[model samples]
Target: MKNWLNLTAVAASVALLVGCTNNPYTGEQQAGKVGVYGGLGAVAGAAIGAATSSKKDRTKGALIGAAVGGAAAGGYGAYVDNQEAKLRQTLLNSGVQVQRDGDNLILIMPGNITFASSSANITSSFHPTLDSLVLVFKEFNKNGINIVGHTDNTGSLQLNQNLSNHRALSVANYLTTKGIAGSRISAYGVGPNQPIASNANEAGRAQNRRVEITLLPPQQ
Candidate 1:
């Protein structure tokens, strides 16, 4: 599987570069109207791995690959590019970290702003940020949304796992209320298993405790 991904990545990279064109209006570089459309195809082509190595992330890459077939390569890139731009604008100063990884988009909501300490309940102040995301989800309904929950290693494994699960579920349910179909969403908890920063310090732990919503564009 890894070897196949590597080969696919190489081929996709070539396709992406060849498919790209200069932005005529802004004189900026951008991917073509169509680019490599595969779950890990563009990610691999861009040399970026899936969001994180969590248990729930195991099938994320494959599902995204299968969801977006190669047929939608061109328009898929363009769609995601527009969505990413909108997300960056909406999330500006909203305390959510918006990033474009490869051809994919990730919104990282820190534990500090998302939830109170040792709780899965979202803070009242976080609602506006979510509202902005809901608008995007409704506008761009074709993307597959994956909500992954994570936490620090301070708590027991089981406790942390359950908290993570609840946190993910909370976000998923909230999105549903805003009209995003439940079918287009999947939630998972990684507990303390996948920390992006050190768990040894307060600042690092704060960074580690986060919920990542990865928007995977449909090939179409």
Candidate 2:
């Protein structure tokens, strides 16, 4: 069943990529979103097959498109991850709150700065963090990004997700203001599903309420 889903996703991605429209930069058309997504699908399928199944199945599955195709897909994913790693450093240097999670980086904005009581508006002092994100993302030009908003487990799950999405969009808007194109940002909110620290204490709840910036490869 899982394999079936992966196969379906790959086919859908190929069709999608083949149908993409692009704007000319320096009068050159940019396309191939399908290939990018297909690549990711390929890697995910292989990784799961290897970890939970057999090496033979994994190796055989990877040999699908072409020997080099898997490498290309895997390499591209790693390259995007490397950019995220570098962005972590940039965030730290810029004095933003950041935490590293393997390939994903967490940007924590405490309740004191991210939003007003039960509101999604970021505080005035947090402006610098958004500005710095724009700067860093501008510099990291090869990939797209996803901003996920999070909140403490203090409200309805659905409401928190909506609020989180709003916060992420707010950040994305600020980045757009700083010259980054809106199309380059993918924003969402997952509510309180992922929390870095315990929420039983004040400090933990503060840490729980935050936004995450995941530098993603162009949506393929």
C-alpha lDDT of candidate 2 relative to the true structure: 0.65
Per-model TM-score, in order, reads 0.70, 0.55
lDDT for 90 in candidate 1 is 91
Q: What tens-digit string does per-residue lDDT give for candidate 1 at 1-220?
A: 4643564455566556755768878998876645544323455422323333344553454334433443345456668778887998899988888887766789999989999988989898999889889999999989889999999999699999999999999999999998899999999999999999999999999998999999886741
The regions of model 2 sitting more than 4 angstroms off are: 1-89, 93-106, 218-220
The numbered model that scores best in TM-score is: 1
Best candidate, lDDT-wise? 1
Clashes of each: 5, 1
lDDT by residue (9-123, candidate 2, tens digit) is: 5544553355354554555555444355445555565555445545556545533533234445645545655565566666675445665443345565565666787787778
Please give the lDDT score at residue 139 for candidate 2.
72
lDDT of model number 1: 0.77
Candidate-wise lDDT, in order? 0.77, 0.65
RMSD of 1: 11.4
